[model samples]
Target: MAPANSSAAAQRVIGFIRRTQAPRQSPPPACPPVKKYKSLTEIMAKARYAVVERDDYSDVLCDQCGSGERPDELLLCDKCDKGFHMKCVRPIVVRVPIGSWLCPKCSGEKRVRSFSQKKIIDFFQIQKCADLKNKCSSTQDAKKRKRRTSLILHKKRRRLLPFIPADNPSRRLKQMGSLASALTALHMEFSDDLTYSPEMAPRSANHADFENGGMQVLSREDIETLEHCRAMGRRGECSPLMVVYDSCEGYTVEADGPIKDMTFIAEYTGDVDYIKNRENDDCDSLMTLLLATDPAKSLVICPDKRGNIARFINGINNHTQEGRKKQNCKCVRYNVNGECRVFLVATRDISKGERLYYDYNGYEHEYPTHHFV
Candidate 1:
């Protein structure tokens, strides 16, 4: 009887403990039911109509050239309302379309395609096409008359040529040093040629009037060579130049091979920004791109972030005779297709293993180069 009573008391204790303990948590509430659509087409249709807001085109400018002149010639995109010149559109729109026309951005079509897909402007192709046509005409003329042979060996004019970059990618990156990282951080990409931002677009005194800008126009041969160099640069090829570290001068560009006079070393390339904006900035590699008559319209190329081998080339102390003697390249600004572009040309024949130096202040002597090495 005593053993039965003890067993019964233990059972009662266990029952009380189980009752006092907290109840098990209920399963998580069922997720709300997902709305069902008849088909993907129905969902897409709803999405398309969801965006009801329309862009304003009251004072539209050409999206390509960013000019408001000749408003009659501008074609407005039906969806985004962005304006573009008829001639600027690819497949050249001669006349306004009968119905709604969409800009490249609104239509989801790429404005600029890869080089492999399109031949780009006829800038380089013009030379080759002309040469072929000339050859055909010369052959026909020869058939009609006897050809005269001249024994005089004429000297071929040496034009600016593109730089052949180092074959090793690691070596190229190593030579670039902190510039590569700086470019990535600034949201700027390495470019071999000048790039125009919205603010730096040609305006006022630097407008697209090529003939009236008092800018130097390049000859046909020179233009062809320049275009070729630009294409090579876009493809990541640079002049046979290397960057080396110096204790005093920091990074300096050295010729990997003998560079002839009038050779195109590299273009001063970077984000073209207004001078007023960068006045307080501490960038050391700024190059004067355009000096508009209006002070507000002046622009400068900041190459500390985005630039080619040209950025590494140190400046010479023009005040010193020795500094002037070390200079082998000259920076010249030219107007290409109504755009201001800076090119570094060999002022004299540059020897292999020689460092390149140019005047920082140009002819104005505005920049102090006394401390330059």
Candidate 2:
């Protein structure tokens, strides 16, 4: 027998106990889901697709230092198909065969071939020159270059053949080869016909005394002596023109050659060495100049950048008592020595192998190679 209000309170306690007894479930997690990654090879595989569109490459790895770095990061060799950084290889032009660019550890191997017992460098083989000859061809490209070169050579010969001091006609060539000496000898045959006497021979074989081969430059006092030589003949001295060995002629050549006196009717062509030969003893007495009767041609002359050739031509042979213009080649006789050697208003841009010659001089280096004799 319980009171009604106490009965209601007992029922409330029972309900609270039931609620507390129920199992507690765990709260849901707050973090996001985990992710998975592809392998390194797979990643690199994707990169290749992007890189394939780029240009050519050598090996995938560096060849020089054996580094594993990619080829694009290194300097690549075109011929060998290898890659190296600029620093990893020896300093040389990457191109060209004679010069070699070697890797740091190329097994201590000699990289370049030997020429004349020396490592080939800059692709030049000087000793080979005597044995070497121009690789001539009948190809259009080769012929065009050859013709241009020949014309230029002919022009230089015309401009410079007369100023050689009467010593050895190409004494310099005797040391070089038989070919050049032949050219010198051929050029001098015209001398006898040209009116110069031939006392300046035998000295051609001597090189040790080559510098002292002829007359010293005429000093101021020498001018008085030259004047005396001219006056020795009497009254007015031999004509002012006779004091010098010059002759002038005019003709039109390629405007691309050297420029010179346009008014005269005779000219000279190249190789200072040739002119030096004429000035030398052997041919000096025997040589002569040739000219054209045609008015369409004129004389021309060119000088070295130093202008020494021009100066020597212009210098007074005090004994002869003549200065430059007075010694003009136009003053000489025609066809007596051969073809005219002068040109006027021609151009001067010579080709790479083309010899840069002048009428009154011969090459320091002789013909054939046009290299230092």
**Number of the top-ranking candidate, with TM-score as the measure:** 1
| lDDT of model number 1 | 0.64
Q: How would you encode candidate 2's per-residue C-alpha lDDT over 304-368 as one tens digit per residue?
A: 11111112222112222222223322222122112332221112332222212233322111112
TM-scores, one per candidate: 0.52, 0.15
- Tens digits of per-residue lDDT for model 1 on 1-373? 9999999999999999997895978889999998898977567545534421334434668887788777667786666556787766553453578867877667776433223212322211312334676546645543432211111113354455444456774444443433343233334556665666666543433442332246676666567667756654444344677665453355577887678777778778887788878887767778887777676777788876567667778889889899889989988887777777788999888888899999888875656678776
Q: What is the Cα-based TM-score of model 1?
A: 0.52
Candidate 1 regions off by >4 Å? 1-188, 199-213, 234-236
Each candidate: what lDDT?
A: 0.64, 0.28
Supply the TM-score for candidate 2.
Answer: 0.15
